[model samples]
Every structure is written in structure tokens, then in C-alpha cells.
Target: MSSITSFNDSLMSHQNFVLIGIPGMQEKNSWVAFPLFVLYALTLLGNITILYAIKIDPSLHEPMYFFLCMLACSDLGLCISTMPTMLGVYWFDSGEIPFNACISQMFFIHILQAIESGILVAMAFDRFIAIRGPLRYRSLLSNSVIAKIGIAILSRGLCVCFPFPFLIKRLPFCRSNVLSHSYCLHQDAMKLACADTRVNVLYGLIAVMCTVLLDALVILVSYILILKTVLSIASRKECLKALNTCVAHISAILIFYVPMIGITVVHRYGKHLPPIVHMLMANIFVTVPPLLNPIVYSVKTQQIRQRICSILHLKRTRG
Candidate 1:
């Protein structure tokens, strides 16, 4: 307890923080940057292609594709948020970040995450409408309605995440200003504070519960209702077709949430585990969803697949 008080007494507002990249793999970071760069580039390419395809293809201008475009936009933002710090760490060995810049990065990262979760929930509702009431789907999700939904998603993300940086700013940091991951995360930044963080902790918990957890629950319920609708179809072939439409979305949800949950568990309870384990999970959580979502959609979504194929001039052979 005395030690804690001593640290608190010495606490001063730090102007800069150092990001130690890949705790034990400093020597191999230069080499590691190659694959990471490739993955980032591919993610950019995939998401851009999805957006472009939807933009040019008139047949793709529907509510489903609009939500997809929103998802791609969020994925692109997530990539941009993490790219500089991550690549800088591995490629140039530059990891020092100013306090305000760190706060900005942390804000964008969390807000984009919240936005993406909301997008998934929106997409699930789109699917539920499409399956549950195909006739009313178009009328229900009209252009104005979709626009309003998009606005609400953005507004909710902004409102929920805007307080995070301020919360961190009010706390004094006396502990070593080194973060666990290469990029700024709210939890990671909060852990270095020398003051009482109960408010921060409680607020963070409320934010996660309201956004991510609530969004996941909504998605799950949407799918369960969708499954009931699919099962009610009279023909096996029709049921299979309806279920297939959801495969890409289900894959996206799994990739995003599974890694997110894994990283959370590792951060909270995996102190005895290797530092490398934590590093890898953080990287995967941010990187994989953007990299794989487009791929999954391209393969599972037929119109998108054909549009992409035509754009690439790849001839599809009839089976």
C-alpha cells in the first residue's frame, strides 16, 4: 500500500508513451512486417473492391449491399486506425506516440469497433427482413429508412465512445508508460493509470455491455428467428437456399467476436501466459475480420462474386 501511494505521489501527466512491439520478438519484427504488410494490403484491396463493385453494379444497389458497403467502410477505418502504429513498430522500429495522438488513436479504434458491431446488427436485421417477409423487405427498408439507420449507428458509436479519451485524460499515470499491444486500446491505456480507475472501469463495462454485448444478442436473436423462418419453408431446396444466404454474415460475426472475446479473456486472465500469445491475439482481432470478410462475401454472395469476376475479367467456366 505504501508503494502504491509512493507511485501515486510521483504521478505526472506523461506527454509521450512508448509502444514496445511484439514483446519478445524485437529482433524478428523487420521480418514480421513483410507478412503483415501483405495482409494489410490485401485487406485494403478486398474492401475497396467490394465498395467499387457495389458502386458500379446497378443490380447490387439494394439494402443488403448498402449495409455491406457500410461494413466495408468500417473495416477500412479499422485498418487505417491500426496500420501506422503497427507497421511503424515492425518496419521502422518507431513506437513513441504523443499523449493526444494516442488518445485520438484509441478513440478511433474503439469507436470504429462499436460502429462495426452496430453494422453487423443492422445487417442481421436486413437478413431477417429479407427472409421473414420477402414481400415487405423492400418497402420496410426504403432508402430513407436505411439512411436513418446508418445515421443512428454512427451517432450511437460517437456518443458511446466519445467519453473514453476524456476518461483516460483525467487519470494520472505514474507507472511505466508502455502498452501491451502495438496500438492504443482503452483497456491497455487505462491499466497504466496511478489513480482510482473505478469510474473508467465501470464506464467501460457499461459501454461494452450496451454496444458489443447487446449487438451480439440482437444478432443471435435475429438469426434464431431467421432459422425458424427458414425451417418453415416447405421445400428442402428452398430451406437450403435461405440458410446459405446467411453463411457469409455468420462467418463474419464469428471471426470478429471470437477473436475479440479471446483477446478480452487473455487480457483479463492470462497473466501467466506468454506475452506473445497476447500480442498475436490483439493482431488477429484487428486484422482478420477486414482481411476475411470480403473474401467470405465474394465466395458466398453470388451477385458480388459475378460482379467481381467481371471486374477482374476472369472467365467463369460453366460446370
Candidate 2:
């Protein structure tokens, strides 16, 4: 017990944390970096293409495309936020992050995550409006209203995540300063603090409940209502057509949420699992959605796919 106490005391003023690439597998980080870099590169390319497609085509300036653009932007932000630390850990063997930098990193990550959740809800709402009342959808989700919704999503994320850094700053990290992943997470950092963290834990739960859980519940309800509306259509073909519009959004939701839920479940209940399992899930939760979102949308969204193909064809002809 004395040894433990002394160890804790020694780290009471820790200002740097060493982030991990893959737990107990540090020697293989260079190999791990190859796949991760590919994913990051693809994420950047796909999302940029999506944005460019939307920008060059005025026909795609509707509410749906606007929300899609927002989703792409948020995914890009998530990738950019984690890229530095992630590459540092894998490529350069440089995992040490200053206290302030770690706090800021966590803050940006959580805020962007919250924004992404809100954007998903917004997309669901867009689908609901389109299917429920196509005539009114134009007036209801006009450019002004869409802009306001975007601002609200950003504001809400900022407000909800604003306190996280401060809350984490107040806690005393008096133990091992090695984070379990390439990036800093609020919950991961909170666990190393020597002081009481009830407030941090409670607030973190509340934030998740308010942002992620609430957004998911809202999306589910929107889809339920959309389903009812679709069912009322007498024609089977019409019902299928209505459902087709939602395929991309549903794919995006599953991509983001499944890995997220996997990470949560693994962290909470998979104590017996190998540490690599937990690390893999954490990395996937951060990386996979961004990599896959654009591809899913491109393949499932006809307009985006056509625009991208034409753009590629034009470049080829020019070359």
C-alpha cells in the first residue's frame, strides 16, 4: 500500500500523458499505421469529393444535400482532430501530450461528436419532412431555416461540451498517465485522476444522455413516424420508393452508432476480453465512421454518385 501511495504521490503533478497506439503491441504500431493512414486518406478524399459535388451542382442545394454537407464536414473534423496524435503514436513513437493540449483535444473531439449526432438527427428530420409532406418540405426547410438549424447544432454542441475541459482540468491526475488509445477521451482521462470524479462522471453521463442518447431517440422517433406515413401509401412501389430515399441516412446512422455502441459495451462489460479488443473498438469508433460515411452516401445516394462520376469523366477527358 505504501508503494502504491508513493507512486501516486510522485505523479500528482503530471503534466504529460503518453498515448498508446495499441495496448501491449507497441512494436507493431508501424504496421498498424499503414492501415490507419489509408483509412484517414480515404476519409479525406471521399468527404472532400462529397462536398465538391454538392458545391458544383446547384440542383443539389436542397435541404437534404445541405444536411449531407454538414455531416461530411463534421466527419472531416473528427478525422482531423485525431490525426495528429494518432500519427504521432504510430509513426514517430511520440505519444506524449501536454496537459493543455490533451484537454483541448478531448474538448474538440467530444464537441465534434456531439455535432455529428445532432446532424444525424437533422438528416432524419429532413427525411421525415420529405416523406410526410413533400409539398410543405420546401417551405418548412428553406435555406434560412436550414442555416438556423446548422447554427443551433453548433451552438448546442459548444454549450454542452464547453465545461468538459475545465472539469477535467480541475481533477488531479496522480497515477499512470498513459492513455489507452491514440487520442484522449474524457472518460479515459477522468479515470486517472486521483481526486473524486463523481461530478465529472455524472456530467459526462448527462452530456452523453443529452447529446448522443437524445439525438438517437429523436432519430428513432422520426423514423417511426416516417414508417407510419410510408405505410399509409396504398401502392407497394410508392412505399419502396419512399424507403429508398432513406437508405443512405440509415446506413450512416448504423455506421456511426454500431461501432460507438460496441466501444461502450466493451468498455463497460468486456473486462475479460483482451486489452487489444478494447483498443481495436476504440480505434474503430474514431476512424471507421469517417472513412465509410462518404462511401455509403455516394453509393446509396444517386445524385451524388452521378455527379462524382461525371466529374471523374470530365477530368479524364481533359487529361
Candidate 3:
């Protein structure tokens, strides 16, 4: 009975420490929960709708749309894995997650993040084949090839994220458990470790550099090749159409990656910045891409916009 009581007391004390910074976490956070909630809800619904539409539409069964569906699905997973927990903590003051739950959140967040990175790389490759080798596009990126790429993406994501949770598990918690961010980010969580986290930090950084940064470099090369091919095309109309098709994808990639780089740089060097600034950058990195992806694709892709309108019309007719 004495040991149980002691354990309970220790748990309560840890909880108290974690809650201490909660009051200061987002004390001045603009109170935009309602808007953010609605936006996230729409993102979830919109992405799901896109995935379903592509799956069901016979005309949309090509490699490009197949990859778009995968992108939508990954974005949906990303938002679902991170946004709810973050919004709950930020808006409802329910930031007190158990240690295990926090670790789980960190794991899934990183998994989805890696998946997104891989999907972007796959999309860039898809565009490369379509533009540079148009005649062989269908034969090269067959259904089987796409399935193999999808499996590889999930596998790579799991492999990259495997070390993160394992490292977190080994860490001894001695300091305050209070996390400064709305969600349980790996680096932020590592700061609470009393153990030597040099290994964890090094492994995490290496995985990110290998996966995300390397993929970004490949994407840049693909775009450069694509630009050269486009410039060599004979007809101005074909060039404009090709460029316009790529514009939405380019915009989405920039919005997603630029803020991610900003967050990484700030986390590495701008530790002295105000907490609000850190929080704002984190929010931009997390929220903006999910919100902008569907919008950009819908505006750029006539098929997606048409399907959305058709779905809306069906709902209105039913109502």
C-alpha cells in the first residue's frame, strides 16, 4: 500500500509539472480555434472526397490521378495524426497527455511526415516520366509499378521513424515533462530527456536529412530536367499548358517545404525567439500545407473541381 501510494504521488507530481506551462502555452493565441476546427474538418472531408472520387471514377485511373489519390490519402493521414491532438491541446486546455500517449503521437506524426515526403518524391518522378517520356508513360508507370512504389513509401517511412520511438523509450525523464509546443514533436520531447540524447538527436537528424532533404534534392533535379524539356518543346500552347499543370504542384511543394526548413532552422538556432514566434512557425508548418493542398489542386485540376461541384450538386438535390 505504501509503494502504491508513493507511485500515485509521483504521477500526480509529474502531472502538475506538465500542466504548469499549459497556462502560458498559448495564453495569447488569437482564439482562432473555431476557424481552425472548421478548416481541418473541411480538409479531412475534402481529401477523403478526392481519394474516393479518384478511386471510383473509371476515367481517373491513370498514373497521375493514382498518385494524386495517394497524396490526398497521405495528407489526410497527416492531418488526422497530428491536428486533432494539437487543436485539442491548444484550444481546450487539455494538454495533459500520458507519457505513452505522447510517445505514440510523436511516432505517428513522424510516420505520416515521412510518408508525405516520399509521396512528394513519387509525384515528382511521375511528372518526370509524363513530360520526358510521354510515349512510355503508361507502360513505365503501370498499376503494378505504382503499387510497388506505395509499398516502398510505407516501408521507408516505418524504417525512418522506427528509431525515434525507440530512442524516446530509452530516455529517462527527470526534468519537467511540460512540452512547449501544442503537439509532441520529437525534438521538443527530446529536450525533456535526462539521459544522454546525443544518439537520438543524431539518428533523428540523419533520418530526416536522408529522407526529406535527399528527396527534396531529387525533386529539384527532376524539375530542372522538366524545365529543359519544356523549353525545347516546339509549340507555345503546349509549353503553357505543361507549365500551368506544374504550377499547382510547384506551389504546393514550396508552401510545404519552405516552412518546414524555416521551422528546422529556427529550432536549431533561434531558441531565443519569443515562444509565440516559435508557435506561429510551427502552426504554419503543420497547418498551411494541408489547407493549401486541396485548394491548389482543385483550382488547377479541372477534373477535381468538376467532381467537387458534382458532389455538391448531388447533396443539394438530396436536401
Residue-level lDDT of model 3, residues 204-275, one tens digit each, is 889989789899999999999999999999999999888877877788688778988988888899988887
| TM-score-best of 1 and 2 | 2
Candidates 2 and 3 compared by lDDT, better number: 2
Best model per TM-score? 2
Q: Provide the TM-score for each candidate, comma-separated.
A: 0.94, 0.96, 0.91
Tens-digit lDDT track of model 1 for 150-192: 9999999999999999999998888888888889999999999
Per-residue lDDT over 1-319 for candidate 2, one digit per residue giving the tens place of the 0 to 100 score: 9998897666754779889987887988999888888888999999999999999999999999999999999999999999868988999889899989999999999999999999999999999999999999999999999999999999999999999999998987877898888999998899888899999989989999999899999999999999999999999999999999999999999998999889888877888999899789989999999999999999998999999999999999999
**103 in model 3: Cα distance from truth in Å?**
0.8
Off by over 4 Å in 1: 1-13, 314-319
lDDT of 3: 0.80
Query: All models: lDDT?
Result: 0.92, 0.92, 0.80
Screening candidate 2 with a backbone cut-off below 3 angstroms (N, C-alpha, C), the clashing residue pairs are none
- By summed lDDT, the worst window of 10 consecutive residues in model 3 runs over 14-23
Give the clash count for each candidate: 0, 0, 0
